[model samples]
Target: MTDQVEERVLSIFREKFHKPEVTIDSSFAELGIDSLDTIEALFEIEEEFGISIPDDAARSLNTFREVVAGVEKLLAEQRIANPPAAAGPDAAEEGR
Candidate 1:
């Protein structure tokens, strides 16, 4: 999951910054990403992943790896918050 997320995110970084060499270990500073770039990238990420990243987490992320980890954490939290309901006659009756 992390690997897939990392690849998607790295793609976003590459497209946003026009840098084809962006890697998971690349620091934002090393990539010459500024505050505005970070905000834009975060917005793009949220839109792409359907998850909201908190300000603290966003601010704390310095590398691509951290961004991937943060996205994974948010996805886990989303799953916990909205787990799938059991499917059976009882669930159908409850819905009715």
Candidate 2:
């Protein structure tokens, strides 16, 4: 899940900042990403993940890892009730 989110985020950054070399550990400043661009990319991330990151939390993200971690945390919290079910007949039966 983290990998998936990271990939999506990287894609967003690539398109937003025109920096295809961005990596998981890349800091926004290191990638030449300004606050405005970061905010725009964060908006894109929210749209892609269907999650709302509070203003304070959004402001706190400085690196790719932070963004991915924040998204994963939000996703985990959101999925608490609808935790992913395993595949197969046994898993379905357990739900019942």
Candidate 3:
């Protein structure tokens, strides 16, 4: 999951900032990303992942790796809050 999210994040960085060389270790300062760009990128990420990132966490994400970790954490929390329902045989047995 982390790997997938990391890939998505890298893609976002490349598309949003027009920087193909961006990596997980790259900081916002290093990429010449400003506050507005960060906000725009966050919006894109939220839309892509269907998750809302809090302002505090969003602002604190200085590095690409931090963003990936934040996204992963949000996804985990979302899963815990809304776990998937039983399916197939298990669901049928439960309904019996």
Pick by TM-score: which candidate is best? 3
- What is the C-alpha local distance difference test score of candidate 2? 0.87
Span of ten consecutive residues with least summed lDDT in model 1: 83-92
How much lDDT does candidate 3 score?
A: 0.89
Cα lDDT of all candidates, in order?
Answer: 0.89, 0.87, 0.89
CA shift at 75, candidate 2, in angstroms?
Answer: 0.5
Candidate 2 structure quality by residue, lDDT tens digits, 7-82: 9989999887788899998999987888888899989988998899999998898999999999998998877745
Candidate 3 C-alpha lDDT tens digits along 4-50:
99999889989877899998899999889998999999999999999
Off by over 4 Å in 1: 86-96
Model 2 ranges off by over 4 Å: 81-96
Compute the lDDT of residue 32 as modeled in candidate 2.
82
Model 1 residue 60 CA deviation (Å) reads 1.5
